[model samples]
Target chain A: MSFHDREFKKPDFNRISDVIWEVPTSFKQGMRVPAQVFTTKKLLGEMDAHVFDQITNVATLPGIVRAAMCMPDGHSGYGFPIGGVAAMDIENGGVISPGGIGFDINCGMRLLRTDLTWKDVEPKLKQLVNLLYDRVPAGVGSAAFDDAAGFAKLSHGQFREMISSGAEWCVEKGYGWKEDLAVTEEEGNAEGADESRVSDKAVKRGLGQVGTLGSGNHYLEIQVVKKENIFDEEYAKKLGIFPGQVVVMFHCGSRGFGHQVATDYLQLFLSVMESKYGIKILDRELACAPFTSKEGQDYFAAMKCGINFSFANRQMIAHRIREAFAQIFGKDAEALGMRQIYDVAHNTAKLEEYEVDGKKKKLLIHRKGATRSLGPGNPNIPKAYRDIGQPVIIGGSMETGSYLLVGTKGAEEQTFGSTAHGAGRTMSRTRAIREIVGNTRDMPRDKARAIERRKVEELVINPMIKKGIYVKSVSYSGLAEEAGFAYKDIDEVIDATAKADISKPVVRLIPVGNVKG
Target chain B: MTMSYHFVEDVSLADVAFEASGKDLKELFESAGLAVTNTMVRNLASVHTKVTKTVDVEGSDVENLMFNFLQEFVFLKDAERLLFGKIKIDEISEIACKATLYGEKLDSKRHDLSVDVKAITYHMFRVERTREGWQAFVVLDV
Candidate 1:
């Protein structure tokens, strides 16, 4: 049956609290565990029914522990909804699925703070945005660097090293500061990356697209923090966040390299899922293999390579942003205090030790469209922020504001220490395009183009300009698809997480400029 | 018979979904390829058939065959920067197929690129024969 025809009843959910809901294993025939969703009643009511279907599908997967969980910002995705999290027991026939980690292997976000205030950047905001647009190669099929010579300098050997070493490779190559690696997740390097297992095609795609901000929801924003928006004054001050402070936040993934890896593995897993592993799944997109099998290990090793590629990718972008700042401010990046607060991967499956049934067991945790929210006093967090917790960067739409949250111990107990990544989409891209741009399905090509151009100006461009935000994009239609109205309210999404006690808000940021691909 | 394809809205929050139809296996593959290309660029006529690449893919079933066939185009677009607006199936079978893709290198000035499709997803992906023809539903991660 088509997914749209699927209907869910309110009785399917067993309310655990005001913000938490559960779909018991008895709700579905094949489910091995319950599905827990962290969201308010209003958000839950507004969520698409497919989200529940997909998450319930995840609960039925083999070797799932506790429950298949969805964060506050959960929305429908392929096999598992975005913002879905599940942990599998490695010792008990646990399986690894590429869909759980998403196509973009290490799709993530990074936030860099600066000492400058909005006053210092307000006058040059236009020039700064233009310069950044020129320096960073963005848009469809964008390459590594703007200059031909710079792109050519990246040789095959260097590319291999970069994937193996991740952000450290960037630092070694003098692309970023040495201290930058410390604040990154896993020191910006995930171990057990076997580059030999990576297909040649994936490597070729990785070579030229290391430093690009690819299109469709990926962006870089310049933001300001107002004193009233600081919810936790002591914690914000400790993180060097002050009133009127300017920060740079960018969201992207491992680019085509990660996509190719996921593509290759999904194909391979489809063959092994039923034939070799004797595993049955509700959907082909949830294709997987036993973690101990050769196919699974090979995919894990190659996935590590993809993860490293993303780390290196963001590191290079951070370096370029620093360069743009230096050019605009007439000072070195260090002197401008462009310090990286943290870099976290939202799409990944990491092997971690979590308490399960009063025993500390190592589980393979898959977090898609979710961020690692390690609470205060967690030894995994960086030394500088151990007392405060890991910083979770939630990138809202260009028009709406973003949030900076900290992990909580409650998250560790409930969600294996994970939180929502961003304000999930409330509508589909097709709906957004049809709402903003005239419906072009029946119109002639030229007429449709004219209508789209006019509608884009009236809908996306004008609204953003009125909000005092400068946007530089390669495709107007693409920008229109990501308009603020397309996503759920960031404030509401953040509040859900806070009410659920998964994360605590620290500061809110107002956007001043945005660069989209 | 001429290949036919049209975009269809699905429930994905971060993807573009569509359905393609054809009279037979060959036309089905061709229509699916065009659907993916059209998702990337607005106008299919603007992409001239200046270049050709022979694509050979093997799958154990019709669904796998369709998945591999469409994914080859995404790889070509990203790796070679080529966008194919037309396809000719040289041969086809349940387990394997070969085709020649006709398109040109992507030129930003000429092609009005719309969205960057990252990969073809297997979520609710299907290829089936109907009373009149064959059909497939595909979701693209953008």
Candidate 2:
């Protein structure tokens, strides 16, 4: 049978609330707990069938606490749904799975607050975007592109140190401001990262890609915060967001290095999982080892390196962005008030303390394509905005706007401090391409695919331009695949999160210019 | 059928998936390798062969071998900044495979590139001997 023909148990969801749905353990034989999904009824219906099967499969894993939860943006991913969040009891036979994280470890969102408004930026927007595009390497084949040589040049030893210390090393190298680390998750440095656990192949792959923004839905956008979009004036002011303020938001991660690290451990775990641990998973991508085992500990150490590498990667890119803005505005970045509001990672497995059954417990929380939404008063949050809560940046498509949100107490009590990441894909890339270029098979190989380019420019790019959003992309075909219509409505997703009380929406920032990978 | 590979639709929500078939294991590996390169480049024929490199990989089984073989190209694209126009299998087996890859270092001005594939994921990844020949299914995380 083909892949789609493979049998998967359909979940019979019981409505726990208007937004919360549960699939009891009886739905799957191996399930250790029920599976839960947080989404509106309409969005839950729109979710792919594979999401139910995948999240239920996650519930079967060892030491899964409470339930295997999927956020509103959940979609069918390899082992867990993309917006999947699961916590494991480490004192038990809890396991660490690379699939639970992702190939691009710590792939995340970063927002920089600038004092300039749209009025100040509109005239120089094109010049600024082109310069930023030139400074930051993006899209496929960027590692080999000669232009990127001017962006970041690090020696082997220095590269190693950067991965070990994350953005701290970058600040020391004068890549960013000292205050920037305070708003970054984990202070932009993950503890227990051992470089020895990373392979030479991984190091080589990651060395040149440090500051580059690799492709596939990764982007850097210049957004404007209109006054009407800001929900809470006090919170917005606290976060340095003002009416008509121009900001820079980018989403990226550790490039090839993280992929290689995850690939290495996934293969290693597959070799020993069934043989050594006697753990049988529903999918090979869910290959895992017990938390306390040598293999698990080694993978965790290596994974931290991936996390740190991404932190440093974003830092360097932020530095470049600051430089570009400084050059364009004819002022220092600090003088332009380019202070970073926050940087939050979505793809990660963090060990955090949460209350369970009125007792404080430390659990290894695996958030793949899910953000950590720490509630107000949580000590983990930065002191400056601790009363407002941890900042959650949810990136939408280039055509639609992105959002600034804050964590809520409801998230801590209900979902283990997790929320949706973005407006998840409702359409495949092939489908998106077909909508633009028609069937590839029907056209001759040497036709130059001029029609494809024209269609993308007309259907995707032109529409965004009509909306006054300037876009610069490396490939028209790549741009077409990321058209806003391919994703679920961002407004609906934010509403779901708000209704669930997991995250409180602060403001919606519309893109004025975008550099898509 | 003369066509060796085709992109599979609807199998993955956000990534690319494809199927390839060949009369033998050598041809199977070649067809799959070409599919990988095709996924990244708008037109496979546009890539002119200039540089040749030999790649060798080993795995526990046929499926793992296919995964490792394809991952080598991804590694090359990132580490060495090479993109392949063509792939020829020098040797193949259930556990190990060796191949010669022909392509030039990436030139942004000359080549029309698409998404950067992160890795070859094991999700729904399969390789099997069919009635006609050998067939393999692969999902690429872009």
Candidate 3:
């Protein structure tokens, strides 16, 4: 039967039972193949139709294999929705677009589990939040601290080390430990990043941004793990998540450097997209080139720079968080038992071997705001985590809880082993401000105006302004876009996901405090 | 047409929008261009015209349509010191726009603004019809 009966934007289809929907090639014009979505009817209703458009766009890209996939938290983005995933045949005509990678670049999230539980932090939530805010710079132009330290405003000749070493570079630079890389995605690095392709401006942005929790979707959150956190806790502990324990979670990426990189390439891609390949684009943001094309190869190389820069950036932030804890507790970082659980990036086009037509072939997979949830026993996963699969850290807003999930056995065939990034934006930022000021009263208007002013200033503004990165998106309901109340209850979303058997949930993280920027 | 933007600080802050209608698209676009420039420099009178350039922008949609057109003007002002004093829209297509903006080279000492508008941003951008005709809203890069 056709999807017409569904009565949705792109009528939802069936892929893997009812949990997954495949938008077959016949569903849309210029669709090279089907676009698969991992969402139920209830969750699908809440998603943005723009996400489907992005998925369809990915499907039409050269060298794409299997299908363009969207996780449960799918939302609109520049070229690819935040929770979109697609793999391409590298040898064929796999293409790469910086927009597909996103502006933050490797803005991934990491979760750290400590021995202390919420019982340890319930009364001290205010103290801990105040302490965290004071220690970690939130909001814009926060890297003044980077300059305070001996680190140069910008680094050189070390960008490559960041690519290969990932978190290790920060560790070597005295920002972190060598062991941290083990808990990071791809050891906190994507291999084959060519730094020479990166522009000097991008490098400048990366220099001070490392170790700084930049403004927007970039936040440090305190979450309490729940028992029925969504799926299971024993599996959560295997992923280093525990019930009632305190965990530090945040998401950011290669900041200005990454944005500039994407910006530079977007402009460059537009010039070459038509002349070199004769490609016509529906959206300027969707500009892309074949992976083998000189322009495409150059962009991939540059994007890897962004990925590596992000790995280093998160590593530095982790180090700073550890420092804050040590300072407050008057104990060594090791004594506090702040150990790296896992860090996973939600963006990038990686060359991986996946089954296409039931045969494994190397494909360039572009995952924007979609975490790579490799199934169990994958060699890429560490020996410790190989049995449980890689840890997927899903960050939700301060109001809605975050989740820790493990890859399911069937995820490989379903989504190339991928999962959602966070609670997809439920409304636009402009709408959020306007909704909060429904009456346009002087009080809320003043606050909104302040936020707007601070945001434009690019200074150490309010943490909420930083939410601009994960700007809320909605259609009919404007109030739902205002705050956490707008997002699907993270707990309920997790339940639907687990019940649907997309990924087995582990730890439920109820946020107590937040530091946005 | 003349335009003015006043950011009054009541409890906090807000960019109060104000515009004057014009006879043509050139005047309309020029007034909007001045609104953006006003955010930076104290006045545009100091930045004289050493050179001028024509910018053509294309977008199938009306929103991008106005955004790209304004951006080129902003780009010339920032990068080339071409402050647009007058504008003349030759043709406006469904997706493309052709315009002639008159301005001269930039002098940092003269057009001394606190935040340098590096480029125009695509964030929270809009363009719509007004009682007079069409209007565009944009945030300048600083």
- Leading candidate by lDDT: 2
How well does each candidate reproduce the native contacts, as fnat? 0.59, 0.74, 0.00
Question: Per-residue lDDT of A178-225 in model 3, one digit per residue for the tens?
Answer: 778888887876677777787765565455555666543567887677
- Pick by TM-score: 2 or 3, better one: 2
- DockQ, structure candidate 3: 0.08
Candidate 2 DockQ category?
medium
lDDT of 2 at B4: 91
Q: What is the lDDT of residue B27 in candidate 2?
A: 89
Clashes within 3 Å, all models in order: 0, 0, 16
- Candidate 3: stretches off by over 4 Å: A1-16, A155-165, A228-233, A439-482, B1-142
Give per-residue CA lDDT, model 3, range B1-142, as digits (tens): 4333222111101111223233445555556666655444334554455565677888758765665665555445422335655566778665777777666654433443322333344433456556666555454422
How much is A360 displaced in model 2, in angstroms? 1.8
- State the displacement of the C-alpha of residue A455, model 2, in Å, after optimal TM-score superposition: 0.3
Q: Compare the candidates by TM-score and give the number of the best one.
A: 2
Per residue, candidate 1 scores C-alpha lDDT tens digits across A374-421 of 999999999999999998889898889899889999899999999999
DockQ for each numbered candidate = 0.66, 0.75, 0.08
| Alpha-carbon runs more than 4 Å astray in model 2 | A1-4, A7-9, A144-151, A441-446, B1-3
Q: Return the lDDT, model 3, position A302.
A: 81
Please give the distance, in angstroms, between residue A229's alpha carbon in candidate 3 and its true position after superposition: 3.3
In TM-score terms, candidate 2 sits at 0.98
